[model samples]
Target: MTEPGQGQEPERAGSRAERLRNWWRPEGTWRRGIVLAVLAVLLGIVMLLHSRIPNDVGNLGSLLETFLPWFGLCLPLLLIAAVLRRSATALIALVLPVFAWVSLFAGQITDKAGAGGNLTVISHNVDADNPDPAGTSRDIVASGADVVALEELTSAALPKYRDGLAKAYPYHTVQGTVGLWSKHPMSDPQPVDIKLGWTRAMRAVVTYHGQPFAVYVAHLPSVRVKLDAGFTANQRDASAKALGETIAADPAKKVFLLGDLNGTMNDRSLAPVTSQMRSAQGAAGDGFGFSWPASFPMARIDHIMVKGVEPVKAWVLQPTGSDHRPVAASVKL
Candidate 1:
């Protein structure tokens, strides 16, 4: 009996030693990667309070908001690191960013496209130096849009577009660098002063099915990112303010604004416009609907915004010769 009890004591001591080893090992899930846990929390805070970030320095807040959707990529990267480090703390902290991102953008991932729309409109920034203006015009015709808006039109290429689109669109108007063409009759066409001293914006009343609505084509001043000046968007911001005022003053109840806004809906600088209008892509699009740098669209600078109209569906078209892809949207009214 004494010999059997001695063997049992040795076995119990061995089990206690194994438990101690596990507590101190690097593989312990709860005790490792405290720094990683802190970083995960910080990431979540930045995403959650993005709107509060100051834009006084480099328009940093607007810039981050422009690419806000891309921030989700960090979650998977941090998740891999947490797993490798065996950090239960970091893994739990990561839930904040995951929840914030999902809450902000999960609806965009699900298809919101529904059928039954009366009008289809297309907007494109045909590059000033496009190598194939005629081909681009042909592509626009193929899109089967009832109304088309083109920006950055050059004097040399304007005739080509006019000729290519003549039969399909007999009623058209051009003001400075932007133009609008519609199958329906257009009246009261005039250039809008966006403080640019040139015709980069225009408004016209288009009669559709005996009902009239105001259609605006604008190419807001472009923004540039400079190392010394940060986001040089003061000029664009001024133009946006002026354009928004003009749109607000219009007596028309239903309005459509199309062309290159040069800023996304998320950018606070464009709030003058975005505050009053609704983005077709955000309301009823299939996906992100990025439309710039045609080869690889990272942001959506071009827009189809509406007031007092219902967006049915929105989508991006196949690439044209221009640097920006065309955007098309259908509306109920």
Candidate 2:
């Protein structure tokens, strides 16, 4: 019933429509490439602004730092896809995250390789209920720390730590659950009120190698997790702010703080102290160096921070009988 030219024109139009649909449909490789590119761009921005922005998004910082290194895994996957799809643009996008990670940790690399100058320090959260006080003491003493600070000291466990650490640490002071065990004599030891019940944080002046330095040992309140509340980091943040004020008031220029902060250095909640102090591990550690819930460490909650000391080496010790691992660092005053 149709003319020959009219039928041929309809067929041509149908074919053109089919070709357009095929061109617009996204294939598997193309979809993956787009996703990788977007992720890389977002992660790059996060890295770029990490220092400027406070990491104190409740428990968000802790969560991110715990899983941050894992993000690097996506890099390899992206690279493979880029090669297979021949996506030069997508490949370039992957470089953003790599650069961001390097920028965030670049200072640490240089500090670790630098020469040591004069002090050795150790920091640990000796669990209040630890069963092996002697073993904990032995491990710490073996670290050769000129000054040792301990948090979570209990009345029952205090004597045990003292007796075990007596040979190496002659001068020491206990303020509530926090204490300082030093190889040199201590002067002006006093309790610091971090607004936690009783006294769980304290400060002391110790003369190591004839040089005077203000030392602080603190056990910030533990963070909690709940279904309703994702991460309860409020108490820790308040305590950090109070502690920061105390440190800022100190007369000594050279200061050291050691403890189980219950938060990572990357966490913005601890910005009060973190802003002023340099983390020993972040300055000189080899890897992620997590130290928490000793059964499986996903975050570095234990820290050794210095105000006027240079770190030579920093590392986490093997697990004792506590829920957290001890962090040790060799430094120069």
Candidate 3:
């Protein structure tokens, strides 16, 4: 040996390296905590800057907004992991997403309890290929809507819906693929051209309880998002613009639009309609009230919008053997 403590120094240095490896190993809980915290940070960033996400690629921003509510699931899972591992770091990091999500969506939630409304109205897109038109019509009648607007009214199912609702409504009119039923007198049924060559929209004046109001029913052309073209459905956009123009031109002091617009209020593609009218759901619904893909609704594509009426309640109806759930709203004329 060269020196008395020289060999001992080498041994201590080797032990130090081993200890360092142990501290930085994959099995450490601290590493897991760090990962969770980083995820939380990423979520916070996404929530805060969602609008910046480019839509040119595939209308990715709108697609994200469509299912944005699901993002809230992250906080609970992170909190559970933190509790199980006693991870203070992850627990504290959860505050990021909590604040982020709250800031973005909290304002949308509100109380909806009310005494009642003067009129009940409903809208639906009973899928043209529905197998049981009778059952669907029965369910809608049971909903007790004073005025009902129906879209996607195919030749095969139109007669069934008319006969099924005749007794209850007494007054009805259908123009093109859309129709309207009311418990009061109806006048001047006209087709609204949505740039579709053929008609898929209509308007009428429904006189209920001595008050006549303009009602429009439409089935906007569908939109598609593909790998090559993004969410560019030129036809639907053109139709929406035309519909907006027609509504703007109408002379009625009170106007209501009911339809399967195929786009949510949040989608920029619907700016024309959303900008012109106030959504009954946005004003009075208890919750998001999504009404599509009847089995598992993820978006509120069906709508009841009003220009000069006051909505007192808004809600989504149960499935009626159709792909889209019916939407209902009560209002004061």
TM-score (C-alpha, index-matched) for candidate 1: 0.92
Q: How many residue pairs clash in each candidate at the backbone level?
A: 0, 6, 0
In angstroms, the error of model 2 at 53 is 7.9
- Model 3 has an lDDT value of 0.86
Q: What is the lDDT of residue 114 in candidate 1?
A: 79
Candidate 2 residue-wise lDDT, 1-333, digit = tens: 866687787789998877556643465333436766787788777666654544445465555654565566766777787788765557788889888777665564443535654667878898978999889999888887778888888889888899989999899999998889888889998999998778989998988767888999998998887676667878877999999999999989899899988888777668899999988888777676788879999778899999987877788889998889888887877
Which candidate achieves the best lDDT against the true structure?
Answer: 1
Q: Which residue pairs come into collision in candidate 2? A: 55-268, 56-268, 118-332, 118-333, 119-331, 119-332
**Candidate 3 backbone clash number:** 0
* Top TM-score prediction, candidate number: 1
Superior by lDDT: candidate 1 or candidate 2: 1
Estimate the overall C-alpha local distance difference test score of candidate 2. Answer: 0.80
* Root-mean-square deviation of every model: 2.9, 6.4, 6.0
Rank by TM-score (best first): 1, 3, 2
Clash-forming residue pairs, model 3: none
Worst 10 residues of 1 by lDDT: 22-31
Candidate 1 per-residue lDDT, tens place, 238-327, comes to: 999999999999999999999898988889899999999999999999888989889999899999999989999999999999999999
Evaluate model 1: give its lDDT.
Answer: 0.92
